[model samples]
Target: MLDLTSMKINDNNDNNDNGWLELALSSNKDNVKNLIEIKDRLILAYKNYENIITEYTTNPIKSTFLQERELLKSFYEKAPKNLNRNLLEQRNEHLFEQCPFCGRPCKPSILDHFLPKDLWPEFCIFPNNLVSQCDKCSTKKWSHYYSDIDNSVKFIHPKFFNLLQYIGIQIEINFPSPESIKQPDFIITFTLPRGININDKKRLSLHIKYLDIKTHIREYITENYLYWLRVSEQKRYYVPDSLNQRIKESYTGGNNNRWDVALYLAMINNDFIINHFDSIEIKKEIQDHSDIKLEILTEE
Candidate 1:
């Protein structure tokens, strides 16, 4: 949900420096030569990444080494930790604490093969082919690059696409009734800006759907909205500005695509919420910071 277009990882370890690969294949010397020979070919396929999305059929990056797929994948797994550690570390410098793919407030701990290593073993160690992602997003994604039914790309490539510039997340809150304000229904949605083409929009929508982004967003909003409401209620004077500032703080240190921040902004902007701000119920449990407030009393 954030733009990682500026992220440059493993710049020092390209085709020229196959030392990492060499080390990985040191034990098994037989395939080392074969892999090293195909280094240029593998890098070419990586450089042609953009075309792969559009033309999966004709792209030359398919799984060709059928018999050696496991061996190639093992090279990626067995590579010495220090060799490609930069790929993990540098991704944090640009993305900060946000996962580039989902904008979650966690460092992307796993290196997910943008093109699954199982399917395309040639690009197993290709730095450009790996994406830093959170556990849930990586597990959920699980080698699904495109839809089997339609043959379209399933999600936005964080490194390739400028996500925040083109797509924005919007929240629509629905109150049960004007008089009652126990909790509102938090609806999460995507808004494509003017410049994006229909095809890109379709892809983005599919990306959101496949990743279950809307559900994650709704859960985030629902869990945090009441806490924010409590904070706003605590500020007796200059409530609007204080509330807005509070909401902005949630996303200020990280990516702007935070769903909780969006939900709070939507609440503050809504006329009904602003007008009836005082009346909105802040549960006693929320105010006390613990849901279970009842103390067990023993009868004498």
Candidate 2:
């Protein structure tokens, strides 16, 4: 789990929404035309709302508002079928990766709602409240309602949190868990600044709960363990001295260290390690082993 609060929203001036609209227009032109058949119905609904709003002279009645709501809903129901698909695809492409909480490469594996759409219908379509989430961190599953605080409804928007500065990932080995007796258990805790506001803390907690990040960490660790086990087995009976001698006799540079070969093989087989290993740790580990040197695969 990574803190990813600093992902910036693109400027509204840029052709973001318009681009999506254009894409939808081009791709679903025929469908859009078909939807035009309902234009008369939408116009009728709008006219009904206008008539109620204009003719009702008494104090605004509850029924009037309800009627207006129904009218708007009906209009939308009759709208184009692909009206929002392009926007959704565009958002998926642009906001799908990078943790919304920490703005890191946790590659937001999911879409997150800063505000529960069901509880806060007004904010359902609010762009600022939508965030990309990794599997281990999101707001969808975790309920944000707090009983202790009065008038506390809003969650800390990732746009305002700048999560990279406020949060850090801590991997706890052999962490105590209720399920420990049943299987290998570990916890990846997301540490945050101690003085963070209660609402922010709750928001972060919800993000973690929704993502099931601890599960992701366990899976990652298990996969690495198996990979290392395989490598260990491959080198169980190998004599490094004899291997190096054979290589020297044959004038081949490949068999210098079976241990090194084993480690490399293990790394290659582990997807999580290949994808998310700490570069700094790798550098320090390489430095500790005088027999090996780290090589830069890409320029920063």
Candidate 3:
């Protein structure tokens, strides 16, 4: 199972141009309209911030610009809370990571409609629908939402999803693969659906399409499959004691649990041990042993 050691708060890089809040405040509409206005404002402010960062690299900034930076920072410090504090904080932190889709290493200044907000305004503010992305990937996948929303909801949220519920990680001794050695790779067949009925399926599909979970899976495979395979071969003859100890040390060092998953998958797929270990059985065992549970509401 994937272990979440601790969640760390990222550095505050909030730029204080409260144009979005201003838009929300100025909106004459009711609650939903106000929410939409606020959403738009957030998007615009992010875009503006992105532009500022972009220009910083190429255009020399005047002393006045540096002064404005301090002003913006102060404004953000005192900005009123509008949404859930935890969620807002997480969103701000996510902005620091590169876009998962395109590998662009910058926080996007605009909200991407994984499923266009137009189609499912209900999820416009859902944290799962919001991911920090660069401009190029945002434009490329602009209208490309998921085809299966129901399936999408079943998928894990990178920020909030529990990896242990539907899937588990472990290093199997034997599996069939091109690499002669055993290693780990993530494996799972079950999908999630808390209770989405037929109608809900249609709606869920919208969310799924928006997030591009399928694309994520493919990307995961392409990126880690071979790397894990190589690891398996190198460590094949190594005793489990040493391997487990190494893993324990790495865990203590705060390596991501996804690394373990990669090792599990590689071990399973390698041809050296297919008959010895049942991949599915081992997977279920891992899930059962894990502490994480997937549920609709956030854990309190």
Candidate 4:
């Protein structure tokens, strides 16, 4: 996950300057002037929204312009591409190679509404309300912001918490019995930094659970193990050193919480894997019964 600390609604270009509000207002000719009255209020609400959502007990924040909800949501839904083009570009300028939501080494391709547009449509076009995320994560995290049971905010706001920098994830690989080396099972867990607040800790845990982050990491490792193993063998580099180089390269730029980086770090720390690198044989069964010397094409 990435910390989009620099991205916020107020910091972005005013939507009014781009005539987005005007374009959206054009359709509702009857209520145009009425809706225009709340334009500044909406902007102010978007700016101060994050501050009010400080704790689990805090009530869900909605537009104070309750009577204008339909007009605002309708305008947002029917907004033309040109209006969004600039805003989306501005948001993407700071996007990292990794998705902000999952940190899966893919640049974010879609803008996810932090609060579902169905429920809180006033902020539908708000820059702070839009989270840049990969398609898979966006699909998985679709419209999920708060817990249904407790009605608490679930996903940590990237712009506010900067939680990715505060929390670290660890990988634990568990090999099968000595008789079976077919596949190694693994677990992904979080390592919280000292002095993190209780609310943030809960938010982190809820984010991971809500997004199914651990399961996804585990599946990725299991599915891609042979591919990485084959690549390492072909390159003829020391496995530990290769892993170290990878971790160093990708784990730079203040993002040390990536799952792939965590995997490499875990392998580097495991004495069994490190010491047995040279002798670690690619068993035939594990290699789909193909000879190790033959070219093996594995999906990334």
Candidate 1 has its poorest 10 consecutive residues by lDDT at 7-16
What is candidate 1's lDDT per residue for 117-229, written digit by digit as tens?
Answer: 77777667666677788877888788677676655777777766775445567888889888655478776777765777766777777777788877777776777766656
Summarize candidate 4's per-residue lDDT along 1-300 as a digit string, tens digits. 666876654553554564445454544456567667888877676666676555655657664655666776655555555655655675576447877776677677786777777667667666667777877678777766667675667767776667765667788877776533337778777787788888767777787777777777787776666566666556545567767788778877766678778888777776666545655444423654564577789999
Model 4 spans with C-alpha error above 4 angstroms: 11-48, 61-78, 90-93, 179-182, 233-238, 253-255, 271-277, 280-300
Per-residue lDDT for 81-179 in model 3, tens only?
553343356556543444444322246555454434443333343334455555655665664333232333322223332332222223333324645
Prediction 1 TM-score vs. true = 0.72
Q: Go through the candidates in order and give the clash count of each.
A: 0, 12, 37, 0
Better model by lDDT: candidate 1 vs candidate 3: 1
- Using lDDT as the measure, the top candidate is 4
* Candidate 2 deviant stretches above 4 angstroms: 1-86, 95-98, 102-106, 135-155, 172-216, 231-300
| Predicted candidate 2 versus true structure: per-residue lDDT over 264-292, tens digit per residue | 34344444443333443454456568766
Best by TM-score: 4
Q: What is the descending TM-score order?
A: 4, 1, 2, 3
Assess candidate 4 and give its TM-score to the true structure.
0.75
Report the lDDT of model 2 for residue 21: 26
- The lDDT, on a scale of 0 to 1, for candidate 4 is 0.67
Worst 10 residues of 4 by lDDT: 276-285
